[model samples]
Target: MKAVMVSAFGGPEVLAVVDLPDPHPAAGQVSITTEAIGVGGLDSLIRSGALANHGAAPGRILGSEVAGTVTEVGEGVDTAWAGRRVWALTGESGGYTEQAVVSAETLVPLPADLSAVDAVTLGSSAMVAHFALRHAHFARGESVLVRGAAGGIGVIAVQLAARAGAGAVAVTTSSAERGARLRKLGATHVLDRAGRGAQDAPAGYDVILDIVAGADLPSFFARLEPNGRMVAVGVMAGTPPADFGMEMVAAFRKSMSFATFSADTVPALEQRAATAELFTAASRGELVAVVHEELPLEQAVVAHQKMEAGEVFGRIVLTPSRR
Candidate 1:
């Protein structure tokens, strides 16, 4: 099997395509023949030694989101999943190869109407969005704001907020090209992030989903209505510095709270249920994942470069040699 491996960490150039022995599942696991692999920003982070938890080990392949067909079941695994289309979070890594092993527990049946491309893009992004939204404890007909609205998790956050019956939906993006698409995805208002124009955003959004942490935190804190919440998923821009201010204190005094998450913080059952719901929603056309580009497995370097350069508004999928 051919896989993209990061021999060392530094840049996209560190990633190379090499032939490796095909993977076989252990007990309670299954081997999937790659149909599509999701290229995550975190994968780029892992390749660049940015993300703490996903750093490259000497022999590690750099991806965790996979959507493929079950080709073989290991001992103690149910054969019922054989030949079924499935998508999963492969614990840590091993998703970039033509054949990779995943625990049966992580595999979720792909809905009949969902394509491999769509399912792979959802990857961990959809679940993170789900967790953030639920953490906000939002009510129906409440307003919500999403930052980095053109990115993988940002897009999912927009759709999920709309499906949650938000009274008003606002999404912010730096690119002009994504504005129309964001609106189509159910954003009632699209904020132009390029001009530092978030000052024009309507005040009192009940929930703020902050994927781009470069925004004025105090300003976002001020935008929250009394008792509103903000969930910080990613700091794509950069992390904010800790500072003392009355407004920051007052923001908390006004009953606003901020939160973030990791897969380790998500319980297994909750993760399973969220993936199941996402698949169901995709089948119903309520959740739509956008795939902006597809590259062959060997071109993984180019794919990572696109991500690192912030050139892709949606996901980039990888197809193995056999595909």
Candidate 2:
């Protein structure tokens, strides 16, 4: 089998495709013949050594999500899963290969109408957006501001919020073109990356889905209305300063709240349900899975480079040669 691995922790150049012996699933696991692999910011962070302390190291495969067909199932797994089309979570690694082994429980049967590219694009990102909005207690008719809303999860969050009857769906994106695209996807207002247009919402936002958390996090937090809730789902700009929370405390009189959410904490059954719902919505044309582009699996390095450079507007999927 051929796989892309982090030969060293550095830039995108460190990702090298190499040949390896084929892997077979163990007990309770299944092996997938990958059709498409999703690439995201976390993969870049791991490749750059930013997550080394978290067990990301040299020689590690650099992918977490994939969409493909099951070729083999291990002990304790159902034979029915073999030859079934599915999208799966490959934990922290092992997805950047022609064949990936993952626990059977992690597989979500792909909708018949969904393409492999769209499956990988919306697979985990839609789940995160769904749960993150729930964490923020988002309600219909409430205003929502999706920070860093041009990325995969952010794009899904925007549409989901709008579809749920949000009174306002505002987004912070890099350019007018990207913002225009978002507007068509249900964003009511488009702000620059610095959140310039947010001032138009005089009462502030009722819910803020922040995918970018860093020095500018406080600025967005301040935009929340009284009794507003802000859910941090990603730290694309890097972690915020330690004292950033003091601002939230200072605004106690507003009764505002801040929280961080990750799909990892969600129960497997709930996650699976959400995944199925998202896929169904997509297949029904109720949700759009934005894919910026698709590259051959061997070009994994180029995929990371585009993602890290902020050149990608949505998800970038890698298609294995077999696909």
Best candidate according to lDDT = 2
Per-residue error for 114 in candidate 1, Å, reads 1.5
| Local distance difference test values of all predictions, in order | 0.82, 0.91
Cα lDDT of model 1 by residue, 1-323, tens digit: 99988888788898988888888889989999989998987787677776655445746887887888999999999899999999977765578888888888888888888888889888688988888888888778999988788888888988998988999888878765687898888888878763245455566789988877764655665778888888788878767556614656755667877777566688877888898899788888888888889999889999988998888887899988685
Worst 10 residues of 2 by lDDT: 194-203
In the range 193-255, model 2's lDDT, one tens digit per residue, is 888864565458999999999899998899899999999998889898888878789889999
* TM-score result, candidate 2: 0.98
Supply the global lDDT for candidate 1: 0.82
Q: Which stretches of candidate 2 lie over 4 Å from their true place?
A: none
Judged by whole-model lDDT over C-alpha atoms, candidate 2 comes out at: 0.91
Best by TM-score: 2
